[model samples]
Each structure stands twice: as C-alpha cells, then as structure tokens.
Target: MLLPWLVTCLAGCAVILSPVSEGCGPGRGYGKRRSPRKLAPLAYKQFSPNVAEKTLGASGRYEGKITRNSERFKELTPNYNTDIIFKDEENTGADRMMTQRCKDKLNSLAISVMNLWQGVRLRVTEGWDEDGHHSEESLHYEGRAVDITTSDRDRNKYAMLARLAVEAGFDWVYYESKAHVHCSVKSENSVATNSGGCFPGGAWVTLEDGGQKLIRDVCPGERILASSEIDGSGELIYSEVLTFLDRDPATWKQFFTIRTESGASVSLTAAHLLFVSKGNCSGGEEAAFGSMRTIYASDAQPGQCLLTTVTGELVGQNEEGRKGVGRLSRISQVNMREDVGVYAPLTRHGTLVVNGVVTSCYAVVDEHNLAHWAFAPLRLLHHWTGSAGGHVGDTGVHWYSKVLYWIGSLLLGSEHFHPWGLADPWR
Candidate 1:
C-alpha cells in the first residue's frame, strides 16, 4: 500500500500535537487545573467514529468481514473507518484481543498516519496473544498493545511511528528487538485499567422471567455470540459479536473482538455472558428517566401552574381538554452559589409530568439544554435551612444554621469555606 521512501518523507513531517480534552466537557469540571497550552491544530480533520451507526451493526469499522461460519482476520465497527492495513500473514498465532480503549488508540494512530501520508496503509505484525512468547510484564497479555511493521526494514520508521503513537494518547510506545512498533495504553480510570476487561472465553446462559426460565446454548447460524462491557447492574454499556466466523469448536473457543453499539471494537470473552429476556410484550428495557418530561411553568402561578402541552406526547390529557395539570407536591426553587445569591424563582417552580403523574418539581437545565426535573413526596426540616451560605455568626439563634456552618467549616476547611449548593431539598 506504499511506494518506497515513505519513511524519509514522513520523518520530517512531524507535528507537535497537544493532549485532547477527554474530561472537562462542557458540563463537567476542568480536569486538574493547569495553565493552558497552545495546541497546533491538525491539518486534516481528525477522524471521529460514528458511535450510533456502529451500535446498529455497521461494517468496516473493523478490518475484516463479519458473517457466519467464515474466518475474519481483522475487523472494526464499520468498514471504511480503518486507516491502517494489517499484514495478517505475519501474525500467525498472535493474540488480537484487547480492551476497547486500546483499540481506539490504535485506530486513532491509524487515522493520524493515514492522514499524514494520505493513501498509505499500515501493516500490523503482532497484537495480543497468550502464546507464552510475550514478557510477563507485557501489556499485550491484557490486550492493550500492538506491534506494526515499518516500510521495508526501516528502523527509523519504527522510531517515527512510536513518536506518532504517543501523540495519539497511547501511554507507551516502543520499538521491539523483533522489528515491530509496540504501543500500549494505560486506562484513564485506574480501577478499569487495573481490572481485567469483560469475562474471558466461556459458556453462558440468559436468565428469563426472574429465573423462572433460562435460555441456554446458542445454536450455530442463529448464535451471534456477543461480548459487552456492563455496568455494576450488568446492563449493556457496549456490545459486539463475531458474525462471520468458522464456528468450529476449535476456532470459536478463541476470543474474537466485537463492536459495541457505540461502534468501538473490544475483545470480550464469552465466559461472562448472561442475557435475561424480559418476556413477550414487556417492551424490552427502558433507560433511566426515559419517560419523564420537563415543562417550564415560567408563566404559571405557583398554585395554578399552567402546562402548555406541545407535541401532545410529552404531557398527559385530562377529562377536560385543558393544557395544564395540578401539582402533586410543593414547588421548590433551586438556589445559587454560597457567596452569590442569584435566584431562578420564576424559572424554577414548575409541575413535571413523569410516567403520567403530575408533580411539583424544580427544573435544572444542564449544559446540553436538557432539563432535569426532580420530584420527591417527602419534605423535612433540613429543606428550609439548607443553603450555600451558612449564617455562622457567633450570636445567631438558628441552631440548624450554626450546625451547617460548623459542618461546612470542618469539611471544606474554614479558610476557604464554601458550602456545596443544595440541588434539591431532599439532598
């Protein structure tokens, strides 16, 4: 996929790229505050994977085809997203399994290299394999690294590739004695990085109807064996499966990579699979706060909150065809900072329609413009006293306020005391 002398040309074409902001998103806080550094903007637009398309079974995000009873050497979420081409012939018995995070960094490098040399293909020689050949301390065993061959025995090309990989968020990149570019990733989150990714190769079953029935043994042809990273509750965070593979007992036992709905490919072992069917007519699973709707009663009086029900689906209808519903609880206002006392009095009080119940609630608009309406039936004494400002005057009569002042001083340090804002009265 390349004409000769590509390394010499690329050797001088280096760009000092800056770290991309992964955390500190618009609504999120700035990560480990430091002086801002000037970033050299990329020449070509950096590639971004289509997460939605990947989740719905897009092709080519992987390196190879996905079908039943066929061998796939390499694969990504969708077909066209790959920038580097691997020399599968070199990786005879090497392991290819890796965490999704690792694969993403690799793909990012491929994108960078491809953009740098506009049509050249990268050939990967080795990836994760448990053949007892890799070192005991190797990140390859955990599926966090890969080795790629440079053009026609060019050692400097290997060094250049290592430099490029490090710029793409890979924590470690080294040229091995065996002549391949090795790169590894230390996860941003410590726990996930330290812990081994999703369960390794095994047999599993899906629980149905509260363990009343269990579906076991996915037969071939219909069995799209899947691997997914699940949360503590075991809900799908991402999911991928090998569609085209020689499902012979010998071949299927080995770990195959899968692309989640998010389009990120990850190595998952079949050992931890446990799907639970919700039964017919159960409407499958509903995401959290899925049915809740927030209507701004900025104009409505506190007791007689008027709901301008637009699009009809968000709010409910009553015996009389009116647009508004009565409040289920007392309307509360979300307050401001400790030193500052800005208020959203009119904008705060509102009635929320959640799962067909009209409740008095306060709406909190997030960075993305989505409103979070909270509803609670109970009200306590702390609700009236909670504030970012604690009146801690030594002569104050309010014991609750004094207690809060002391608590804030103790926890936040008295010198720079600022009480955490109370989002809701319940908290």
Candidate 2:
C-alpha cells in the first residue's frame, strides 16, 4: 500500500514537470485535452524581414564581412627550407592563405617534423582550396584546414606525422590518406584560449615554501617544487615557474581524470603527461625510476603504475620541510569529465607534483625531460624579456615568442642549433 502511494505521487510529479501531455483523463485530471501553459511574451521588438533587407542590402547579408582582407587571415610562405613545399606553387599561386591560428599551427607542424625527423620534409598539398573539392561547410573554405604529407612516403611516417600534428596544437588531425595528414584549427571564436596540456583549476601544486596551492593561483616568477631526475633518488628540488596558463572554461574541452589506487587523483587535459611505470609493481627507487615513462592522460589505462610521493618525512629537509619519497601507485581508473577549467604552470624543471602525483609540465611528448631541454631557448627568451606572464588566449603568441621562432629559423640555416641531436639515444 505504501509503495503504490509513492509510485502514484511520483507519476503525478512527472506529469506536472513534463512539458506536454497526450490528454487529460478522469483520474489524472480533467476529462478533456489540455494545452501547455503559454509563457508570457518577451518585451523584445519583433524582427521585420523588410527592415533587415533594407539595412543589410538586397543580398540579405551584413556589409561588415570577414574576407581575405580581414586581419584574421594570413599569407603563408614556405621560407623555412626546400623540405617545406607547397602543392602546385607555380599554378593557382595567388597566395597560400589561412586563418592566423591555422597558419601558426601549420608553422608549428612544419617545425616539429623538421625537429623530430632527420631528412624529412613536409609538403603542403592543400590549403584554402574552394574548388568544389570539399563540402560547403568545410573549414578549408574558412582558411582553417590544410592537407600535408611527408617526402619520405612511408605510411608509418604519415601516422607519426599525424601524432606530431596533434602535438603541434592542431584542433583536429586526421590521417585522411596514406600519403596525407589532414590538419585543421578551430576558428578563434570557437576554440579555447589554452594552447597546450593543462590541469584543471582545482589540482594542488606543491610550492617551494613547503605549502600547497591551487594551480590556477600560481604565477610567473614563483618557485614550485619539482624534480629533475626520475630515478628514485628521493632528491626533490625547487624550480621557478616560467608561465601560468589559465584557460577559459567556455570553449575548453577534452579532459580526463586519473585516479590512483592510493586515492591520489588529478583531472587534466587529454594531452597532459603523467609519469607512469612500465610494470605493474613498484620496484623501489632504482628499478622504478628506470622503468618509469611519461604517458598522456588520454592513453593511461587501469592497473598502470604511476609515480607518486608518500606523505611522511623520508628524505632530510632542504630549506623547505621534509622531502617526499617517490613511490609507484597503481592506477584504479581513468575517466573523462566535461566541466572543468584548465590551468598549467610550466616550471623550470618540467616536472611538478599535482594532487600528490608526479607529472610532467610538458605535454604531447613522451620524453618530458627532452622536450623541456628542446624548449630551453624559448624559456630563456621569456625569462630575459619578462613576457612569460602574457595570457595565451588574449595575446595569441606574444611578440617575444615570434622573435624566438625567427631566431630559431635564422640559427637553423647556419647549422648551429639542431633539436634532433637532443633526443635520448637509449629511448
């Protein structure tokens, strides 16, 4: 009798909350069809098509339009090397133009390929083509898509190229063909402000002062607890924060939550890297350190061991409080979340402790240490120029960043600096 009464009450509540109903019955309500309650009309002026046509012209489009002449569009030239080629440069060669964001990502993709592989050149097969080859709603029409391939012609190289393209910050990367990797960047209005792997705002970062702070509250010039070595030496160090990236939550997407067996968990972007052990067990400091590798949050799986620090005083104090001892904690779960703002504080050592878990400040690259070394020049420029505090979204690649890219290009022609040489031979 009690169960029946509860069920009837729930049914009545459901009917009341529902937007529409089939018909009213004797027991339910009245024995007649009832219309939904109409909402009060808003006090907005009604739109008139004739007025819109008069103001916007007979074409029914606004006069202020974004076109090739818009500032958001840029003309790209393959000035890096003969390795970077444009498809059909002689014909249909008006200009290789794309959105500014797309152009920047394309440049990054080309530079990454040149830096990652030896004797490999990237060929831009398509850019901003409106020759009826793509769908009407394609990003190509908006100058935000490009199709590329490598000179090597290896299918394996193409797959790696796609991965690199993703790392280079393309919004969407697809291996459209064995020969080409299709990459596209989201429009400025549709994309998030953050450019790289980042942690959600709630993640805790250890400070150099032996205190913990939210990652979003960290700022440039602040020192944070970091580690230079992965081998279980139990040696922890303090590294200066170079930049703090706080992403806008409105357009930000792609997040994953990694929960360890020890109850340590952190939510971060998919591309963010976390130190994970190769085996299932913790083999103490020596064995665990050697077996640990950086894995992206998107690729992390259950049962994988992640490197973390235990809360008691194991190592002696260095200016700060007691040092944390490194330990391997097996992962219990990896899940995706939709609502969270992202933040990342890039430290000098390229490693930071978040929510008691040891993770890399760098993303997309498996070799965290090597990636930090490769970007040393950029970090140095930021330090020297004091431009690290600039917001990624608002500024869209600060002037100092552009200057560094230009310097790298000039130094590359002279054969003075080679990033490929920095890769670890053992790995």
Candidate 3:
C-alpha cells in the first residue's frame, strides 16, 4: 500500500513540471500559441513558341517591319505642342525603319505646321518602303525620307508644309500629289539636289578692277577679289569665277542677315561661310583678327568679330585705287531674313569678298585651301565640259558635283562624312 502511494505522488509532480501542461494552463504567464500562416503558390502562364514565331517571324527576331500590332508602332511624343502619328495600318506593315534624324525633322515640321494652323495634326503615311513602292534611287530606301499628310489634304496646306520642311532643314521637299508631302534628309548614298552653301541676290562682290558688282549680275569667267591666307590679312588677290549658280527661288525659305558695328551688313543663306574670330573676344581689331576661323552664317553670334575691309584710295601710281584693307568689325546683330533669292558662285580660289566682308565660296570644309583642293575635280570638269558645270537658273546640282561628293565620302570614310552638314569630324 505504501509503495503504490509513493508512485502516485511522483507522477503528480512530473505532470506539474511538464512544458505542455504549463503552457496550457490559463493566464499563468503564457498565452495561446498561433499557428503558422499558409501561403498560396504563384500563378504563371505557359510560354507559347508558336505565338512568338508568329509575331517575330520564324527567326524570332524583328525584321525591320513595324507592324500595327507590334508595340514598336506607336506615336512619337515630341517636346513640342504637337504629336507625330505614324499610321502603320495605312501602309499595311510594308514600311521599314526610319532614321532618327528623319524622325526628328518630321517632328519639327509638325510643330511648325501646328503653330501656323491650330489643332493641325501631321500624319506620316510612309516612313521607309520595302515594297518597291518608291523609285529605285529613292531616299526612302536609305531610311531618310518620309511622306506626310494632314487631315485636310488641301493644296494650300501642303504648299505651306513644303515650305516649313525646307525651313526645318530637310535636304529635299516635294509635293508629290494631292495626297502627301514628301521630305527627305541628305544621305551618303544619295545625291543632293542643291549644294550646301549659297548667297542671296543684291549682295555685292568686289571685282579685281577695284569696282563692285551685284552678285546676281556676276557671270562666269569674271575675276573677283579673294585671299588665300586664312588670317585676316589685307593681301587681296584675284580668282576667276568658275561657275555661277542661281538656285531655284522656291528652294530656299530662310536667310541670315549679319550686321557689323561698322554699319556693314550682308544677307546670305544659312550654309554660307564667313570668316569669324576664334572666340567671343572683346579685344581690339589687331587682337581679334589675329586668329580667324570659318563658321556658318546661321552660327554667327553678336559681339563676335568678323573679317571686313576698308576701301582706301591709291597712294601711288603703281597701286590700284579703291583697294580694300582687311579690318575686324564686331557683329552687332544677326537676324533672319525670308525675302531673298539664292545665288552661289564658285571661284577659282574658293574664297571671295562680298559686301566688304571676307567670305568663302566653298562651304562644308572649314579650311579654305582644303575646300578648294577637294573641289578641284568639279572645277576641272567645268573647265573641260562647260555643260556639266553650273548655269543660270539651273537648280539641279551638276552630275560632276555629285560624283565629287561621292568620292569625298569614300576618302573620308563613312563614320566622319555627315552628308546633312558635310561636317568633318576631324575639324
């Protein structure tokens, strides 16, 4: 009886010390334990290789065709007030890719048109065509052309759009039909319709005979004042006029008027080159003229010095009278002019003085001598066959010029030859 009673007391003590019973006891110090939370499995859709091949072709890669169903075919949002819409459905996905430069200019053209006519939208009908829709030599094949149309399709509206395209820096712009306006940027593989640099009518050119003639009246075989030296020295020389080019008035829509502090001013196209000081220096004439460089008329800035000339009477019988002396004049203003006709005359030295300002007949190349050397072929062709050279009222660029430009591209390599500006990366 004693052994059984002892065993029962020991069992009761063991039960009091047990962890499961102590945790279960109500409100002693522990609370009821919570169960672990269960998590649901992630849902995933199965990959379909057939769907991928159907969208991206059997190669499973983009074949340069922007389909209407593709996410790549979307509206371009420019920083301007207008939106450029590419209607891929209209072309039925036949259009290929377009250059970024072309797209940028297209946006600019849209903004310009919208500013003129409020709420106007520019719709791109064709970007690049691989369906043999355009001419064999069309820039569209090179991804440099775009066909645009608005909702109105009015003739007047298209005319305005063409003008705006020119102003927006398109190398070529045409009103193809009542349907669309065609615009293109310059490409390495294509020939440009117009040479880059040209001047306007009413500009004055100093003759070798100490007299000045209107640039429009100046003809081939005439001698004009030019300088071979890059520095702003008054060492004037004469160079024979090789070809006089009168561009189509409709080709140009903008001109820049560069006015100097000495009350001298000249109006010229944006691509025309002029001798400007190295930087914006407020030094004296001698200091400013010490280092001269060539820059575009559109790039000219006020307070910068320009190479000019001052006419003075002959001091001796051996010297010619009314000779121009090189002087540096600070630019007062650079304004845009829209009322001017385009004229560009190629000279033997590739440099000329116009309206008392030292300018270059050749553009694209900053160095006057190098530019003259590069165009040697065109000049030689003109000398041999006068027909291939420039003529009055001839708007098309000569075949020789196109050949020379192509050769230049070959020599300069593809990476450095920018057809749009003819800019040399090395310079």
* Candidate 2 clashing pairs, residues 3+ apart or interchain: none
Model 3 residue 136 distance off true place after TM-score fit, in angstroms = 34
Per-model lDDT: 0.29, 0.57, 0.57
Best by TM-score: 3
- Worst 10-residue lDDT window, candidate 1: 338-347
Write down the lDDT that model 2 would get.
0.57
Q: Using TM-score as the measure, name the better of candidate 1 and candidate 3.
A: 3
Choose 1 or 2, whichever is better by TM-score. 2
Model 1 Cα shift for residue 384 (angstroms): 16
TM-score of each: 0.28, 0.50, 0.51
Off by over 4 Å in 2: 1-188, 192-195, 230-233, 245-251, 283-288, 314-316, 319-322, 378-427
lDDT of 3 at 40: 24
- Compose the digit string of candidate 1's lDDT tens values, residues 1-427: 2222222222211110011122322334435453333333222212111111111111111122222223431321222234555554535434345556667777788776676555555666666545546655555544556777553545545555665665565545554444666665543222212111121223222211111111112221221111111111111111111111111121111122332221222222211111112222121122122222322222112222111112233243334323321112212221111111111110111221211222221221110011111111001111332321222221111222233223322223212211111211111
Q: Quick one: how many clashes does candidate 1 have?
A: 22
Higher-ranked by lDDT: 1 or 2: 2
**Ten consecutive residues with minimal summed lDDT in candidate 3?**
53-62
